[model samples]
Target: MAITIELDDAMASQLRSEAAARQMSLEEFGRRLLAEAMHRIQVSSNWRARNQRRVELIRKSTSAELTAAEQAELDDLQAELYERMETADQDLLDRIADLENTVMP
Candidate 1:
């Protein structure tokens, strides 16, 4: 697929600088950026879907009983969700520290 976009001068300059720093063509860098974004979107979508299923399973368990397999799946989903939350929290803290250092230095 081919697409053309008109970027404002600042954005264009930034992208060009980044591509040069990476020793890549602007088009290749743009493609890589888009691919990374799409991958993140897909990962987020899958996480949401898993979370929905986990909620449903929890509701079912509260009202009735889960099979052994269902219980295992719920446990796995809960663990994964907790880990992701922890990672996100740490990332936020790291970014905040970076900003503070830049501002205070």
Candidate 2:
């Protein structure tokens, strides 16, 4: 899947300058960037797969046929977990946004 693309002189110069500043050859710098990008994509995919499995397990467990008493108890627990997760999500989002605002221009 290797594709050849031409970079105008300005962009090529910029990349060369960046590589030089980092004490890396341009080829090595590009290779490192590509590796990092691939690693990020892989990590993201793994996280998504794990999360999907977790959701599926939760759904299967929750929807099983069970005695009424057991079901009621499970329902109560699930409701509590849902509420806590919702609150945590909001708190996490607020913290992330606050941190971004503080660190980013």
Candidate 3:
């Protein structure tokens, strides 16, 4: 699908500069960014589903002991969730810095 959208001059210039820095055309860079964003959305959805299962497992544990496999799965899920949170936190921080640089500089 092809879509056309208007961007302010500053935004357009910034994107062009970034694309140049990566040695890619603006269109290619934009496509790559969109693909990355879609991947992130899918990852977030998967995380939500895993979180729900984690909650269910914890609730079950409170009522009765989990089997060995269930316990291991819970541990793995917790670690994966923590890693995702850390990565997300870092991404937010990086975006904030980028925005600050754009606005203040």
For all predicted structures, in order, the TM-scores are 0.85, 0.48, 0.74
Clashes of each: 0, 0, 0
Clashing pairs in 2: none
Q: Judge candidate 3 at residue 89 and give its lDDT.
A: 100
Model 1 scores a TM of 0.85
Model 3 lDDT per residue over 31-51, tens place? 998899999899889988999
- The candidates, ranked best first by lDDT, are 1, 3, 2
lDDT of each: 0.97, 0.77, 0.95
Q: Give lDDT tens digits, candidate 1, residues 29-48.
A: 99999899999999999999
Highest TM-score scorer: 1
Off by over 4 Å in 1: none
The TM-score measured for candidate 3 stands at 0.74
lDDT of 3 at 9: 100
Q: Which stretches of candidate 3 lie over 4 Å from their true place?
A: 89-105
lDDT of 3: 0.95
Candidate 2's C-alpha runs over 4 A off are: 1-5, 8-10, 64-105
